[model samples]
Target: MNLQAVLAINAIGIGIIVFVLSLLRRQRLHIGYGALWIGASVLGMLVVSAPPVFRLVTRVIPTSLPFQAVVVMALSFIFIVLIYFSVQLSALLRRVTDIAQHIGISELEAKSQAPERNPVEVEKRGE
Candidate 1:
């Protein structure tokens, strides 16, 4: 890659790292997610800044275009993030189901304890 292009990619990577850090500091981003983004950005910067790293990636990716390598890296990152979120979503869904089940059980128990009143009687009382 050209020096200018490498510099620009490095700058973008640095910007992403800084942005992720700021989000983490402000508690607007989850620590795990922030770390993931920071890690990816740092890796990107390393790949862009170092000739050896580029050579290694090129060997694996076999792409003449740096942009193509970047796109592959980005797609991999997206896939990883999607998997992580899917796991988190599955856990949350399980938790919500458990909570709802507990609530239902509690309501049933409460109803079993309380005296049964006729609906007509309750309506008359309301009137």
Candidate 2:
């Protein structure tokens, strides 16, 4: 299949699906991710679709291997970065959950031992 054809088809399908999901859902983060996916897909297509760009890179690098190796390397870097960020995000969420649980426990303890108000004192204060 032609690269241009694939790019156009995917761009439309992916963009429409993401737009629909964004409209139907309230999750800004998910929407942002979908947008990022769409952007990256389009960018990837643009970069990889042309033969001249590949030729230019091959000339500049003077590599026996094709430019696809470079593309793979770039993808590996992206995957590594994604994994690192995901781990960091998971750790941050765990800390937040711990803090929330601690706060809930503290609040419950405070409420359980709270002193009761006296009716007599209330009446005297009202008088």
Instruction: Provide TM-scores for the models.
Output: 0.78, 0.48
Clashes of each: 0, 0
Residue pairs in steric clash, candidate 1? none
RMSD of each: 4.2, 8.3
Per-residue alpha-carbon lDDT of candidate 2 for residues 63-115, written as tens digits (9 for 90 to 100) = 55665544564476579769977997999999999999999989978897655
Worst 10 residues of 1 by lDDT: 62-71
Highest TM-score model number: 1
lDDT of 1 by residue, 23-121 (tens): 999999999888888988889888878899888887788677866887798788899889989999999999999999999889988879765679899
Q: Model 1, residue 92: displacement in angstroms?
A: 1.2
Global fold similarity of model 1 (TM-score): 0.78
lDDT of 1: 0.87
